[model samples]
Target: MGQVHVVGPNRALLISGSGASGKQPRVIVGGRAFVPWIFQRADFLSLELRTIIIESKKSATAYGVMVSVTGVCQVKISGFRESNSGSGSPKLEKDVHAILLAGQHFIGAKKEEIEHSVASTMEGHQRSILGTLTVEELYKDRSAFSARVRELANEDLRLMGMELVSYTIATISDEEGYLDALGISQTESVKKVAQIGESVNRNEGRQRNAEEELKAQLKINEAKKKIEQSNRDVEVMQAKLKEEVNVANARADAAKLFEEAKLKQSIVEEETKQDVVRATVQVDVESEKVRRRRMELDASVRAQAEAELFKKLKEAEGIREFASAEAHRIKLIGEAEAEALRKKELVEVDMLRLKADAYKEYGQAALATRMIETMPEVARAIAAPLAKTEKIVFLGASGGSSSGPSALLSEVTKGAHIVNEGLQAITGVSLGEILKGDSSLNGLERLAMPIALNAVVANQGH
Candidate 1:
């Protein structure tokens, strides 16, 4: 019959059914089941095996100190499948049979006997090994002790179909407080060494800081010297610049004198040429004078005609200028009248448009409310100038209708009324109509009062 079995990653399969050929099967399976028969973990497993050596029976070290040792070991079925030589075929001995199970499970009566036997065998060897070594040797070189135990126990474990993978000495302790006392002395020595090292490091750090400061001071001194050298260099450069400027100025003056002298020479040469030209024209001038006198008599008559004609031309020119000026003046007057009429029409059109817009936006009452809104600000503005009045003398307060700050208030009201009249004259907004709160603007002032009060408070906060 075909059977499937599951095996773990740490396990190997061994099957022995009817007509089995070998004692331990060569087949090993891992991962998923594939017609598996028997399986068990073949990899290493650890056992925490410890033993106590009584104080009277404690294993003595080389120095005569007795210590109890606790150890653990890792054991596994050996990788070597066969025990005999190549010529002989291997069979499962009684010990191997006791270690391995028929059903492939590791836990059974025979398995326990084999494990106990291996553990006791290891403990016996551990005690024998500790008896040869001291506590000092055990602590300093625990690997050698564990290695020796494993070496000795491996042979016995092999007979049981098991092998020692590793052995570890978990702890070692003495009956007396010898280890604690030894640790205290070593700790004191370490503390003294650490203190000495710390002191040496601190002194070195201070010396390094002093050296750094000295280096910084040297650099500062070098920088100061460089600054002084740069200043000296700058002074030399300035002196050189000044000398070069003086030389350039001298050359400029010399070039100017040379230019002036050359100009004077050229002027003298031009004057000489003019004198020669004048002499040449003098002879022709005498002849021209004689001929001109004879023609003068005829020219006098022509000149009289030309003067009369010129006077007539001048009279006609004056008349033409006067006529053109009158025409220009008339045209300017006509243009001025047209411009005035156009401006008047435009103003009426704008006023009508504004009124229509206002009615559309806020009903017919907006004009009155708009005027009323301006009155509060205008009143404030008129009172603004009075803010400069540190003192006011009320001459008629004793005999007049109002007195004290109330009289001052009355004066302010009069100022506001006067300003309102001026605004009415300029912008044609009637303060009287605004104050009457006519039309839909009747309760607007009450609503605006809170807005104005909030504004004043916010400004004051700022």
Candidate 2:
């Protein structure tokens, strides 16, 4: 390994050695390399190079004013040259100093030495171009000034195997302040124009605003006048409506009163008719009551007369029955009297016969038996008053004392007195006298007694 010379990708190799190349415009080499000789090793090199080109304070005159110009240039290798004989000087084509070895032939050179030569050459051209141009032309037309400088520098840069990529005038200054004075004059002129325009706009705006305010005021007055007229019209309409409503209300009230009066009159007439009808009905009711009472009285009188007739008929019926009964009783009494008289005659005949027969047979006993046969009739006559007696009271003792009267015995005595009273009434004979006088009677008197008894009974019968 003799000086390996491994070239980078951005570099080219200038192989000037005894192995394969002499000075054939720097045999461009990149990537890996091989060489058989050590003392003839080739140097590695780049294909492109960039360098800054700047110039300081170069003086130029314009309109008798002294101005200083400062400028910058960007430079790079653009081409290459090959000195095949490996003789003469290094001639530049694309000014690729990285491989060409600037200012020298058949020898290696540094990139800084080639770049310094480029800068010096560009500065000399820039200063020569500015010396003929004025400051006004350079400031106002920098593009034209820069073009002229590039045109002048391009030939020398090409000869050096370099090209100016870009150039700019960074600043231009003058000790007299010429640009500042020109800027001040132009800026004041623009300011005066803006001030004049602003003043005109202000006046126009004020005039338009005043016209708008006057037009608005006129519309306000017109609207106010119309509103006042409308209010007056509304007041007139309201007054008319109020008058109509009052008249209608008054007429309605009068009509209501008239209807009320008619209703009252109708009600009064109806009440009067009802009162008269009530009085008539009352009188009819009273008359109907009187008629009913009269009918009741006549019915009561007829019932009383009919009752009297029936009563009289019943009394007359009873009297007729009593009269018939009395007549029958009288007829029976006359027949019984006749029958008793006949029987008395028959008894007298029989007594005569019996007397004759008794003198021949029974003697006085037959006379006694004949007298006992009349004793029942005699007792019936005596007890006739007792048939009317409802109750009998014995006022005396149940039994009398031995020497005084006996109630039982008194009853027999009363029967005897009663029998004697009947015999005196019937035969005109006091049987008590016959019993009290105990004188014995001769046959003639005794016979006369029966005849006298018969005659008295018959005469009483008549």
Would you give me the overall lDDT of model 2?
Answer: 0.55
TM-score of 2: 0.36
Q: Per-candidate TM vs. native?
A: 0.36, 0.36
Q: After superposing candidate 2 on the true structure, give the runs of residues whose Cα lies further than 4 Å from its correct spot.
A: 20-23, 36-41, 44-53, 62-64, 79-112, 189-462
The lDDT values for all models are 0.54, 0.55
Task: Compose the digit string of candidate 1's lDDT tens values, residues 426-445.
Answer: 86765555444334332333
True lDDT of residue 77, candidate 1: 56
- Clash counts per candidate, in order, are 2, 5
